[model samples]
Target chain A: SQKIEQNSEALNIQEGKTATLTCNYTNYSPAYLQWYRQDPGRGPVFLLLIRENEKEKRKERLKVTFDTTLKQSLFHITASQPADSATYLCAPSRGSARQLTFGSGTQLTVLP
Target chain B: GAGVSQSPSNKVTEKGKDVELRCDPISGHTALYWYRQRLGQGLEFLIYFQGNSAPDKSGLPSDRFSAERTGESVSTLTIQRTQQEDSAVYLCASSVSGDPSNQPQHFGDGTRLSIL
Candidate 1:
């Protein structure tokens, strides 16, 4: 079966430090991968998306790197702040349609 | 300008009873989806609707779960004889089209359903 795994533990970092999250998947070749930010009791908010052919994508201080060979992706937030604390989710789509299979998110807490 | 909207931000119901959740997609969106999020779990795909094509119901957990969409507009998901395990946040999302390559989904504040 297709499976996606993310860090189950919460990631804590001091203010201005860099926060890195990882997502790994097995038994699937997704065409695109997306990242989302979800706060407690709220739905996920879209963050950034990286395609299979693309090795890396960046938005502001956030960056996403897709390594299809490794079936893994890394999300980074440079200069992280307390406000950046939230659960980050990664979803991958296999076909042209946006039917996504999401992995359990990794919670990041940036202390002030 | 409006995002996807789901009704009854929270619902509490008894087991063995039926419940209906509603979702209003963006005005021009042609694709709608239903998902369930259990506590401490990731989103689980329930169903998908696109234009007038037959819905992809493969994700539904059982016969107790069914959904209906009026064209590209409103969608309703009904759970019959709900079980305690049915408790979860039911989410609705919509994109410009069913072609996943063309658009990203916009989610609404979910309807949290609690079965007692």
Candidate 2:
């Protein structure tokens, strides 16, 4: 069976600091990986995507790195603010499969 | 352009009853998907449909779960004899095609189902 794991523990960080989240997977080689931000009672919003062949991808204050050798991906949010608090999910997709297998996700709380 | 949209944003039903969830994909999108998210858990793939081809229903948990897509547009997920464990937020997403390596899926505010 394939499994995706994110840091299940909640992360608390001071505002204006950098927050890093980790995602690891076993028994799968996804063609692409993606990150999504989900707020309470809302659907996940697509954030950034990185391909297995790509080392890194960035969008504004967000950055993601995919290391196929380690089967891990790291998501970083810089200058985090209180409004940036939400659960971050890492999803990896297999080629020709429309669905993505998501990790458990990490809850990030940026305290003021 | 409109994003994916789901109806009956919230549903509460008795156990053993049947429930149907609807999803309207973005116009012109060739692929649609359904997922389930339990409280405090990650999204679980449920089903996938591409164009007019047969859907990939491997992810459905049991025979009680089924879904249908018409003309590459609207879709419906039906659960028969719902169980308490079936309570979760049912999500629907769609992309220009079934290949996620090339296109990103657009999600809709899911229908939160509560089986009492």
State the DockQ of every prediction: 0.63, 0.72
lDDT (tens digit, per residue) of candidate 1 on A1-112: 9899999798999999999999999998888899999998888888998999999999999999999999999999999989999999999777675477789999999999
Model 2 CA lDDT for position A81: 98
Best by TM-score: 1
Instruction: Give the runs in model 1 whose Cα sits over 4 Å from its true position.
Output: none
- Model 2 C-alpha lDDT per residue in residues B1-116, reported as the tens digit of each score: 47889989999999999999999999999888899999988898999888988888989999999999989889999999999999999999888864765577789999999999
- On the 0 to 100 scale, the lDDT of residue A98 in model 2 is 57
Report the CAPRI category for model 2.
Answer: medium
Clashing pairs in 2: none
